[model samples]
Target: MTDVPSSDIAFTPRVKALQAQRGSRSAYARMEERGGFRTAVTPELAAFLAEVDTAFLATANAKGQPYAQHRGGPAGFIRVVDEHTLGFADFSGNRQYVTTGNLQENERAFLFLIDYAHRRRVKLWGRARVVQDPDLVARLMPEGYEARPEQAILFTVEAWDINCPQHIPRKVDAAAAAAALARLEAERDRLAEENAALRARLGER
Candidate 1:
């Protein structure tokens, strides 16, 4: 049996075999020697997550059927509960309960977070639990957001890694872009007013 590092939780024997066949095993072995992926949230990760407004939660049933669901809120919707834990308020959506049901059967889950504006992405492997406690759900809910909290999802991160921004299409947040345009228009108006005032003063001279 091959010994897998704690941080390399996703690298099973079959995966290692494929990597070896493809000539990538040596590089991954080097990574394992260097402690593999991160098992706890670093300050950089926390900051990155703080600005994440969108994420995808993926889960599988006991029979290995996979499902992915989109989760979005204002920035900082996903809260860093601790070094290895993340919590978020599960907003009342279509009420399908697919994710909740999958979690019950299979705790293993994954989180995919992408910052389209920065062209960065993060992958998280973990176990997830659905919490129906109102106090906990309320604590994770973002203030001033017009979403009803139905429950809370807590993820215990086992391993996490970041990917290079190779093919990610750059995209800015709509709200942020609109605010920038508004500021630019206001500045343009102010400059036009100042220029007109200077011209009037010169005419008076």
Candidate 2:
């Protein structure tokens, strides 16, 4: 496999240098020619993102200090504004504001969306800015969720890459599991009622 990612990838000089020292530069260069590196979101990717309710957002300040935060909501909380743009409603949380502050100094951001049950994940690199437009924020908000939308974050696509499922432990979404349980209970109740109806019909006969 090539060790050098595609040119669209946000691989910095420092990362390339490390790759050289680690003897992965040539492998990456060969690997760069293949894979789902894209400058815009594809239809399959949009559908994948719609199912992801959680992702890890990484940001760095002007001084290069890094901060990572977990963002989540109901499924499809992240909105695909276009093939090249993504938007999401930023909700109120612990008043830390690290992500907000970092974006101010440095717009560079990276996102990791993982489907643990399927052991699949996607990596997105872009520039992000927070906006307070009421109309846009409302459009991005997840329906039926109680979180208070504070603002909206728009991420301009630079590049994106899909990662292999290696090392990812198989896990299930809690909400999906709960929904499955509800369906099973409904099925059980329906069968019970049918049995009772048959017993009553036999007694009368």
Candidate 3:
């Protein structure tokens, strides 16, 4: 994009050095100039996040013991609060509270979101906070999900990166399969009605 390295929203010292050594620094720098990676989310990014039903959250305690946890819900469980903020309701589960504990010890976290059917993924670096506000919990709730909300986990995004679909295997969403079935049934019904109408006209003839 630009002639020189423009920004490093998610790049650390180790990352930049490695990219330089591998001769990819310039390419990455150009990408940055094009806003391929950014510290703030865009409206398009918000909509993408809202439609995903699952994400993996990575966190670490103050001791640096890392933990990876899966968060899921009906589609649209995650809400984009602002360009820089997104969050979801913490549902009642095993009560292990590993994530909650780690967030208390260290707010730093990362979210990995994937869309298997589209073979797309996005990673976000952020700080998470546990919220107890009732209004917020209610606001983030999905329309017909039965999960009990414990607390709201709010992520304040620092930087985000999107990945190419190179190695991601294409898969299908269950809902997509169901939608296909419905379409097939509707087509079949329309054909059957047309056939019946033709038969009646031929009988009259």
Model 1, 67-116: lDDT tens digits are: 99999999999999999999999999999999999999999999999999
RMSD to the hidden true structure, all candidates: 1.9, 3.5, 2.9
lDDT per model vs. reference: 0.95, 0.88, 0.87
Candidate 2 local distance difference test against the native: 0.88
**Model 3, residue 103: displacement in angstroms?**
0.4
Candidate 1 root-mean-square deviation in Å = 1.9
lDDT of 3 by residue, 1-205 (tens): 4343224546767998999999998887667678655777798788788679899999999999999999999877889888898989999999999999999999999999998888989989889999999999999878789989999999999878788999999888888899999999999999999999999999999
Kindly provide the TM-score of model 3 when superposed on the true structure, using C-alpha atoms: 0.87
Candidate 3, 37: how far from true, in Å? 2.9
lDDT of 1 at 66: 100
Sort all candidates by TM-score, best to worst: 1, 3, 2
TM-score of 1: 0.96
Error of 2 at 128 (Å): 0.4
lDDT of 2 by residue, 142-185 (tens): 98899999999999887787889999999988778999999999
